[model samples]
Target: MPKNKMKSGTFIAMCVVTVLFIVMPLFLQVSVIRNAIAWILSGLRYQEYKSAYLGLVGGLLGSWLAITGAIYTQRKFDREKEEKRAIEEKRAKEIDKENIKEICREMLWSEIRQNDNSLSCDNGNFIKAIMEKNDCYFYNRDSHRITTDNWNFIIDKVISMDLELAIKLMHLYKYYEFMTDFDGSADSAFTKSQLDFSKYKECYQDVVEYLEFPWAND
Candidate 1:
């Protein structure tokens, strides 16, 4: 039999036995019981009365033991059931957390690749044209600040797990923001910002390489 069914069966049987021995006799008027009560009431010998009283005590004791055992079994079953349910709930939560992490990883990876491609092509052209002291208007017009939306979505998780990566991404994205907001018409500001672009590009490269070999960070 299953453990639950067996536990229930044993508990029920114990309850029935306890009721029959302890509760039923109080109301039951069988001839044997009636005669016993009469014998006691008639002032039977002290020795005989003492033996009968001892028997009653033994019967009550047995019933009490049966009740105690039944209660213990039921409690044990309940405790085990609660523990099993808790274990299952914890496992389910772990699975859900892992699923969220997986989704975040895929999304982050896509954003990284997209930004890396932009930096290598359009952004690279703009930086090169500026450094060469050539007309950079067309190159600058074709390039824009990189998107940081995807990184923002999972920034908290990334920072919690990898502080170094988080810092690198922050520096790179901040530089992109500066680039977008920089006054390109001011010669002095444009020269300073263009010079800093190399540093931002280095930070971006660091993040990409770190992500590529994530185990090294660990």
Candidate 2:
């Protein structure tokens, strides 16, 4: 049988034995049990009638043990569920990291070819025009001035197929965009901001147009 059922059967058997040995003899007027009870309660004022009190205490203790065991089992189940959730979250993060790596690799090589004028003639001028429009400012702490090196580094890294480096550069640009507006203005920093969308739109269009490459078809 199942372990739970076996334990329940054992407890029932024990309770039956206890009731037969203790409670049954008390009502039957057994001499030996009566003498034992009398000796156990000899020092008490209510010595002749302590069996009921003792039985009550035993009942309370048994109920407490059962309740405590149930609480412990519930906690064990909750802990197992929490551990399983953590494992699933960890697996999902690993899969996301792998996918990001693959996308970064493909985009990097495509940028490199486009930058070097090695891409198809139809797409070469389009890529160069978009790169020219890709301008953003960066902080130059050594020079104590804001400059456009952030945009330059991102473009270079992307063209070199260094996706990790490109992401880092992009973060730097985002940081400065949030930090200071050299344009001298005090406004809601993150509320409403403008982006030069021309370059972005052109690049996206180019990507869609080039999606029919022979390798991509395969």
Candidate 3:
């Protein structure tokens, strides 16, 4: 059991014992028990009995003080240790973010964004044409395009820094995955076109804004 629990149990037991010591006589009709209790109480009048009583009281007080001090010391140590652990964890996360930021900086965002913009614009135009019910055959022009590879490394860490960015990033990449999937399991382009591409555009813009801060500058 924990030290605090043990101490609390001990204290409760002591209180119960003390209460019984005082109250038991009132309930019990035994004359011998009452006489014994009376004799011990009357003995307080003698110097030897008083000294022994004082010694017992002094011993209990000393033990209580010692136990209380030890508990306080242990609690203080535990609190300090917890605080230190939290500080270290915070520091580690900050360091991890910085490292991730460095990785992002190494990536050529300008070039990647340019490619993404061109591809998304073309796809949007195609979707618009198809939505118009144009009889032309749909061609997947951006099928070969891949934009999420560089981001896979730090994508998980980005959530801690900017959850919205992480969510948008995942949303856009999921669309990309859907577009690239040529298997029969994938949905038709017309079905995929009905999605809100504006969100993906917003995601791109957010990524640009997030990475263009002074700390992430080229």
Candidate 2 lowest-lDDT run of ten: 183-192
Which structure among the candidates has the greatest lDDT?
1
1-218 per-residue lDDT for model 2 (tens digits): 96655555656665665666556656549788777767767766673457677677678757755765575566668778999999998897666555544554455445433422321123444223333442332222333233433355444645445454455545434433433343311122212234332333344334333433333322
**Weakest 10 consecutive residues, lDDT, candidate 3?**
179-188
- Pitting candidate 1 against candidate 2, the one with the higher TM-score is 1
RMSD of each: 12.7, 15.4, 8.2
* Full-model lDDT, candidate 3: 0.58
TM-score of each: 0.39, 0.37, 0.59
Write down the TM-score for model 2. Answer: 0.37
Between prediction 1 and prediction 3, which has the larger lDDT? 1
201 in model 3: Cα distance from truth in Å? 2.2
Full-model lDDT for every candidate:
0.61, 0.47, 0.58
lDDT of 3 by residue, 154-177 (tens): 567777765665675576555555
Per-residue lDDT of 114 in model 1: 60
Ranking by lDDT: 1, 3, 2
Residue 148 lDDT, candidate 2, scale 0-100: 38
Which residue segments of model 1 deviate by more than 4 Å? Answer: 1-45, 112-146, 150-218
